[model samples]
Every structure is written in structure tokens, then in C-alpha cells.
Target: MTDNRQSLADLASLTNQPAPAAPAAQSLPTSEGDIAAPVSNEPVREPMPLREQILDKQGRAYATGRRKDAVARVWVKPGTGKITINGRDQEVYFARPTLRLVINQVFGITEREGQYDVVCTVKGGGLSGQAGAVKHGISQALTRFEPVLRASVKAAGFLTRDSRVVERKKYGKAKARRSFQFSKR
Candidate 1:
């Protein structure tokens, strides 16, 4: 048995193969002090690096969200707030009264203190999606300004990324939500 074990080791070394990890002991105590064998061979993943975690946290704290080809850039500054879209005032650029309403609602701003400056640059999507993107961006920027505000923004559903998108359907379909023509003879 000793010679066989030595031969196996020599063969493994010659083949440049690593020795298999030793199996854990499997004996269990019967009303006596003993160790139980590990039940599985799965290797554990290492914990996240502290520096990476910190950077992730910082990124989340001050991040931008884009959607539907519209980009919303938000910065939180100290002062009576204001909002400018493109090079024009938000109200004039947005024009739609209802969108103004949605933006105000999403940002949780009252008529009195809508003063926080939110400068957004959006392109590609129609007016409505741009407004939604801006709302999401502002919500994220606000959370970065105050981590405690995350719950409030999340509860309002403004902080959540809108994942709804156009879906592709089968080749025979007219559109994503449409069906193929009837083939009754």
C-alpha cells in the first residue's frame, strides 16, 4: 500500500497534475465530542473588496439614468432651485401643461419651493419620454444629495428605472403586438 501510494504521487508529479484536494473527514460523533464532515464540495466566493464596495456606493449616491435615447443630466446645488432644459426654460421647452404636472409630481415639488436647479439635456425620445427620463434623473440626483431621500423617491416610483421597451415579435407578425394574417382556406 505504501509503495502504491508513492507510485501514484510520482505519476501525478510526472504528469504535471495537481494533487486532488483532500476530502473532508466524514466521521460523526455518537454522543461524544467529534467534528462533522462538510456536506458539499462547493467553493465559497470571496467577499467583495472594500474599496470596490465603497466606489459602488459612491456611484449609486451620484448616478445618472438614461432611457428611450433620452439623456438626463442632474446636479444638486445649494440655492433656490431652478430647472433648464436645453438652452431654454423647462416650461417653454416642455410646453405641454400635463408634462409640467408630471415632472412636478415626480420631483415632489410644491408650487412654492420648486427652486432646486435641475438642468437636463435630452434627445431622441418624444416629449413624454424625455420628461420621464428627466424625472428619473432628478430623483437619482436628489438621492445622491441625500441618501435618506431614497425611500421617499422610491416610494413615489420615480427612482425606479423604467424597463418597458418595444418587443420584437415573430417574422409573420405585423408588429410586436400584432398577429399573423388568418389562413383559413
Candidate 2:
């Protein structure tokens, strides 16, 4: 520490040096100051929550969906509507129009029908379970592709997984809930 009064006086008397000029590559940014500020003090409204944006290099959204014992790995891409399952067309794989309808309900709710191409592989369940799993997967993938659709998809209830599984058979029961016929003999 300098105890000298001369050093203290020099520091106090020193003038600021000229600032270096910005490079040609850099320029001072312009600001729009308070252009939208509320004039009245009644209340300053909070900004709305923004939806998360998701981007994929290949322009695809991938998701895994499950229902009962079924699981489906799904991929969605922007294109004319086409749904493929395990290398077969949905029509061929699902057979029934009702099953196809179940898988397409998300698109119906979001009004994005015929907008995306879907390719998925499902395993470990029957046809109905597989269809439900695909529907769940489609809803999840739609949200991932466009987060802004979350509200619509969630409202339509496709984002929620069906957790109901087959009930375990009791040792004394013929089936999951069935009891052996009682005989008074």
C-alpha cells in the first residue's frame, strides 16, 4: 500500500484514456428501449410462457410408446401421410379400419392428418394393444416434432399412456377374476 500523498493525487488527477475502436467485423447493437412499456401502473402483465422448440437434423421426431405389454418405437417425418409398421403398411398390419382409426386419432385431434409420415415397429402385444401403443407413440412424436401442439395433443388425451395391464391370476381362481364353480356336494 502506498502511503505517499503524491501517488494518491496522481491517481485522482488522471484523465480517462480513449477507448479502442471496435473491429470492422463488430458493430454496436441498436436497442429499441421500452417501446412496449405500459403507460399506466395498473399492472405490468407477465409474458406468456413460450413453448419449447425441438429441432432434429434429419427433420424427424422419434418416440417410444407403450400400452399393456405392447411397446412401439415410432418415427415421424414431414411428408404426405403414410404409416408403416414393422415394414408393412398400417392397412396390412392392422387389418381393421377401427385399428387404423385408433392410430390416427391424434392426427384427427390435432388436425394434422396427411401431414406426416410414420414408420414404427411394435412388439409384445396383440393387435389392439399394438394399435393403442402406436397411437400413444404418434401423440408423443407429434409433440416432439412440434412442441406447440402439446396443448392440443394433451387435451385430446393421447399423450397419456394406458397403464392397465393384464391382472395376475390368483392361485385359487380359474382366471384373473373368475372363481371356480362352487358345488354343494
Best by lDDT: 2
Native-to-model Cα distance after best TM-score fit, residue 182 in candidate 1, in Å: 2.5
> lDDT by residue for model 1 over 1-185, one digit each (tens)?
46666676888899999654333223544456665755778888985442221113323223466666666766544456577777788789889988877666745632324546666677767888888777787777766666555666777778788987657676878887687788899
Show pairs that collide, candidate 1: 81-115, 81-116, 81-117, 82-115, 82-116, 82-117
Question: Residues 1-185, candidate 2, lDDT per residue (tens digit)?
Answer: 23344455565567554433333313434454624333466776885575665546887899999999999999999999999999999989999999999999999999999999999999998999999999999999999889888988998889999999999999999999899999999
Q: Pick the candidate with the highest TM-score.
A: 2
What does the lDDT come to for candidate 1?
A: 0.65
Q: What is the TM-score of each candidate against the true structure?
A: 0.59, 0.73
- Residue 76 of model 2 has an lDDT of 95
Candidate 2 TM-score over all chains jointly: 0.73
